[model samples]
Target: MIPVGAYARVSEDKALRANAADWREIGEQVAEQFKDMDALAAELGVTITRRYNDNNRPAGDPHIVRNDFEALLVDLENGTVRGILFYHSDRLVRQEYDAARINRLFQLNPTYVGRAVAGGTDLSTQEGRSMLTIQATMGGMEVYSTRRRVARKNKGLAERGHIHGGPRPFGWAEDRRTLHDTEAEELRKAVLAIPGGLTVGEIRKQWIDLGYEPTRNKKKPGTQTLQHSTVETRLINPRICGYRTYLPQAERRDAKRPWMPDFVVRKDGKPVMGNWEAIVSPEEWQACVATIEERKRARVEGRAAHTTSAKYLLSGIARCGKCSFPLMSNQYSKGTASHERYGYRYACLTTLGGCGGVTRVGPPMEHMVEEAFLLEVRRSLGTVAGQVEINETKHDVRLARIDQEIAEVSERRRAKRISMSTALDLIEELEGERDELNRQRRQLVAAKVRRQNISPSLPEEWKGYSVSQRKIRLRESIRAVMVHPAGRGRRFDPSLIEVVWIEGGK
Candidate 1:
């Protein structure tokens, strides 16, 4: 009927950001620390009633109300933990005040923070008190020793050219180059259809229309599953092009464990460049990788233009859906007006004056509808800002290699290594690679061109320009603006405005 408690602290280096818990290691450690308490309780015929553990926390971190460890410490103060027992003293208190309080729970502690009730074995006994003190000191040593061992082992592994284990890489089997013909061929098709080629959208559309299905997730029929980004990554994978890479450290929160020392391994259980057939040529792979990096650099170095006016926020996108028409925007005329409101509305255009009249819209009504729609959108889909990261060096090397291939091919033709027909064939081969590179190059070139030759970014309150100027900027940035007419009035019904797939977060 007596209650006793157990307490434990894990080694400090534990981090749970990887979404994995070393629960097994933790359980074992806790058992080791509380071993005495369990034995003592059995001897006294008392039950160990509670256990508190600081899981995945460093000892030095602040103990806050929201933190689990803080809650456990509070319980200790309230006598919920009869006589706090832990593997060690340092675990209970890294700071002096904390350690002193924990040591005072009982004249003779039992290493068992067992029952707060009266029937537990007497901790005031000489043997019981000594046993608890020895265990705490031992636990402290264990923590320090564990850290030193790990650091030494890691250093040795790095020197031996061995990468630590990590997430399975694509194309290879669990970090090995073992062959899986089916998946390999799928990868082949993916890289072959690179950027600007039948887009993943086009490829999937063709596949689905012809009744193709993936081995996984087959329940959903007629749905295209090749996301644009996924296919894009396949095209740039070094393995696809026959070269194996060693990514000793590639860790990002969204990416595989970033900053963690890991080596590139084939999917099958071998090292990269260990054993495998090259899927795509190195040249093509490099080209794709290069373009990706260039685009990323441009975007990162490129700043975003700020929009200050509400009209600029919803301008081209706020359209009516009835006839798929865009609503015209106008402000209140106030040169001499007594009561003109200053708001914006998107009303469907009226028919030719001969037949009837233009539809009318009011400003305040437009704001009401726009704000409500925005609120709903924000609630349903949380605001997200996606960042694009690229391995710059990898991409740069890839692009240079592709350019080299093209140059080398041209040089061979000039030297007449083969006949005209053969030369033409070689040129075609090189041209294929060149064209791929060109597409990526064009995207970058276009960006630079826009910066140097094109007009500056337009202002939201572009009262400086006429409607004609606004139309030009809209054409530059927008694909289309559609509007639907409601039965009555100059007021735009926000319900009729349907915004389609957009690139960034709204």
Candidate 2:
């Protein structure tokens, strides 16, 4: 027997958490057979190649599909090693998926098929081939059966018209776990604000800003955000929008209403909505679509996600109206609570490692920015007119559009012309679009506020802003404000804050 590669596939998701030890024990037993074959190879003046035993990850999981598996497959075919060593047939692959993989192994290396306990299988012998076929079929059937059970459960759920959600995807992974209303809102916002059409790498970074990192092993990042690939898969998935979609092999016969009990198809050419809770609102999903469109525009222009100037509640966006560079972040520690608070101060934009016409400033300087940037705007707008008129007009236009679309979709539903599934999809699309517009409108309103003679001055009450208030302000203003511990982690002084605007002019 030549050396062999063996593997078992495990989905790195809610799909499956553990494998049966029975499979592993069999693999150990099979290795003994290969060890015996090693001696034979030595007697024939040939060296026994190495054995590759692996844990299978789902193809979607970055770690599952290794080049090494295919590499070993090739070596076995080319006689680089004797044959693959595995515990059992399913231990190798659950199904005979055709893709120039193990199938090629059977054709190219006719004698190279190796398994743990196959009762002396020899493809050249009639007795052995039959045993091999049975084992292969058994393994494939096991996978098929497991999938069937899951499909049945999902179909049952869809019939109830309740929103159904699974282990949340990457960004929303902790939604149910954390159960914070704010966190859920953040998830919606993150999805809504996404530039859409982003690769797995792009939106993941955004999700990370909200404090969830991909669980990657061996430097391969896993997906946690809604990416183009995610969206692509999701669009066709009946589960996301509430239906159980499956391709039944039984369909080979006449169209039998997809009567697999576990599988679902459009009924009478109408879509069916399941009885699961919709975690993502229709409005939010639409914002994601708009973002996807924006992402497409960015990609076509051949630019990476563009980096823009940082903004905070007020000050960071102002710049040293003189220097034009982003404002610097400042951090202070509480001696009593041992917690940290953050603030922002602007320095000359021309300055790099050192300050030009600018030196370090303390939170005392915060008041100056507040007065200059915010209070000044409020004062200026006090003398200006038409703020109310402009605000009302814009709000009316946005409200009108949302109402129109919602009404049109509702009419389609009343007529019972479309399937419940299509009706749901239309609603979701309309909802998402509405949300994106609302968010945009909110931003415009914030900007208009900033434009008016809004009170930018720190209130006399806020002049008493403590470390905690500072912390909230810091978080609200910036996604991240890096306070380089140049003075070591012992004490944070003159920290560099990277402020990002959440809303408004900033």
Candidate 3:
């Protein structure tokens, strides 16, 4: 019912960033500030209706927008709020420009007033506004002065190859020059296993099973264990390869975070190197990064790439009619000269839940699907052959562009104008581009290969291709095979199955 606007703010410190418990300490301070303002509002016989807070955010950052403060000003302009309340005037506006804007608002609206509970400064007349301006200017000066001092200290610490008073990075000692032997070994093992065909999740399981501890969290006063996220961060950080990165702090925005871009530039336009010992070689680090990136792309594009490495006829392409879940293939074999080869049976993974109860023998089903696919391919090979050639030509052009981009980045690195970390980041980006281009090239070539094998001129050539090659051809020509439960009395019935064919793209 009362129309009073209240504001509060606090800046974050290094201790608050490093120690999770320190957040509670900072929260209590803001709470106490609100307590004093609430008392003042009650003394004046008005309830505080709208509250604004910018806790742990910089007040003097030029690019930082104080959303709540701006909203409070909007409310004051429209005469929605009769008065503004704060523990002190400094908390309301630290920057001189912000303080002047508040003065203009008060001048335009003579009836609009502000009250500072703890400070005795009144906000009703000319002398009060002058004092408020002086206090805000002093607060602004303190903020900028502190910013310069902190920047100088951090730059010095970085130049010396020591962490700038935060939690020590994983796999490194407190001094950050020497590797922590046990943790460093785990880091090496994890990074090495990535390129050796182990998924990040698998590596996490192995480390957790071995009771591997992460970097010590001295702020928590307890042992910390390795986590998947922390593992990923350690793998990509150039610091692991004895390189220091300097990311300038910037205002938060919706587009990208400050640290998202490579910011390892030096003041004199020269490369910056680190004095610390390297935990992993640059080649090992790059390989690990590439593996992680490829895995991420696989997850985004299709679940087919994420399936078990077992070469099944339709591991990802087969589905159950009832639950629509993929039918996983299980391998079985009997020891004998004629039966030693692995046999597969496709069954709905969720069959135990009674949703998809279908089970089909792999060999017979695969044979039936292949026969149908060959028939369709024979009828449409002429149309698909033309499109395949067009796609191949397009891929060749894109591959050339990717090669040019790689050369450009290499040239930039040779100029010696950017820091080593920046050059490495650019190189990684170019490598990813190159890898994607090469994958497209492979797809184009494989399309051409399959077109030749499945040509109308040589229809039986498809049968001679490897199982993996046949699987790829199957995916290109068919979308899914939905398997239904066999009819009541029979063990398996082919009439109940539905094959979904993929149309050729022109």
Candidate 4:
């Protein structure tokens, strides 16, 4: 018997299924196809020396490289196999380049046989080569036609706010229109709590402890785990606020890209309302988006969410008066009595680019700063009563104008009117301006919310605030806590702690 190779492939879209039973069915179909190819080889009196299977791989997509197919070509070129067998011609070649490669291989080895279970093609004959070429061309046309149909169907579904086929979205039931009660409630609380100082990391821990699994994990059991990026992506998705967003398959695969406003499906410059029930109001959702975006920007700039040795109120907020370095929270062991006594202090260590000249007892200095912060807050509450609204309006107008400019720049690039480098630079500059405006607007909105929630018992309320909350308030009200070095042997002095108030006390 002459030795030959068998090649088989199943595209990802055709093989993927939501349930185990459906996956088993796809597996059976693949196995049957291989079995038929084996029968064809037996009839042709050929022995199958190697079997190449490219499972869950697309033949037409240029981005998807079929490794097994490439390996089979190498074996054919090396004369390891005298011929190749497949289930069908279309399954073996769906793109013109792929067909060209196979033709070149056959031209170099004129005697090599190419056979399919459905039909046989002798590569040495001109008629057989023409038949294979026609089959490949027809297969490529079919792929294009199928893709166009799927795209049209998906667009129609998105416009109608219907869920197209995929893994079920979080906070929504399998039916897609109804809410998953527990997940929906958790999402709603997260949306509201984020703007009120809840961090994404905190929410991730909360969900993990509650035995919550990511939605995509259902498709492949025990494969995926919850991640911080997943949590942030879910939070920023407009679907929670009853808005449809249609992301192309390519963009969906580019998961590292930041969420942009362009993802939302729009009709006449407004988001298309989804058919599903909204878990949160649009305003609440927008607030969450702004807060998340600000946090992301802060992280990129290395300005917020410092992981310090301790969660001291002024760890990253206060600076050394001499070297202008941020003070870090530190603890030192004192003389031991029955046990060692620990003293907490904020210090400027030379190792951390500080002058090493400033040190202050944590409690006393923190107390003084707290008192001054409250006084500043109280003083500013009366003066900034209506200023936040006015500033927010101005920012909104500026943001809209920036967005328009960005859109125009993108259009010019698409039309080939601008060089790629110039378009990129323009877009980057506009995006930076837009992000800064967004940060300022979110700060104003947060301040407005804080002011509305502030009660007459300001000092009492200050006592109940968490360290993180206090840090946020301090950064808002005071530009920096300048800790100056005190004279040797001088008692703990509040006079050395100078609180520089922010512009207009906030």
Candidates 1 and 2 compared: the better one by TM-score is: 2
Please report the candidate that would top lDDT against the real structure: 4
Q: What TM-score does structure 3 among the candidates reach?
A: 0.46
Q: Could you tally the backbone clashes for each prediction?
A: 37, 39, 0, 0
Of 2 and 3, which scores higher on lDDT? 3
lDDT: the better of candidates 2 and 4: 4
Highest TM-score: give the candidate number. 4
Q: Least accurate stretch of 10 residues (summed lDDT) in model 3?
A: 259-268
Sort every candidate by TM-score, greatest first. 4, 3, 2, 1
Across residues 404-495, which tens digit of lDDT does each residue of candidate 1 receive? 66567778878987677876787677546644554455354333322232222223234443332343333333444444445753454555
| Ten-residue region with minimum lDDT total, candidate 4 | 333-342
Candidate 2 C-alpha error for residue 372, in Å: 7.3
Q: Estimate the TM-score of every prediction.
A: 0.37, 0.38, 0.46, 0.79
RMSD of 1: 19.0
The TM-score obtained by model 2 is: 0.38
lDDT of each: 0.46, 0.43, 0.67, 0.76
User: In model 4, which residue pairs have backbone atoms overlapping below 3 Å?
Assistant: none
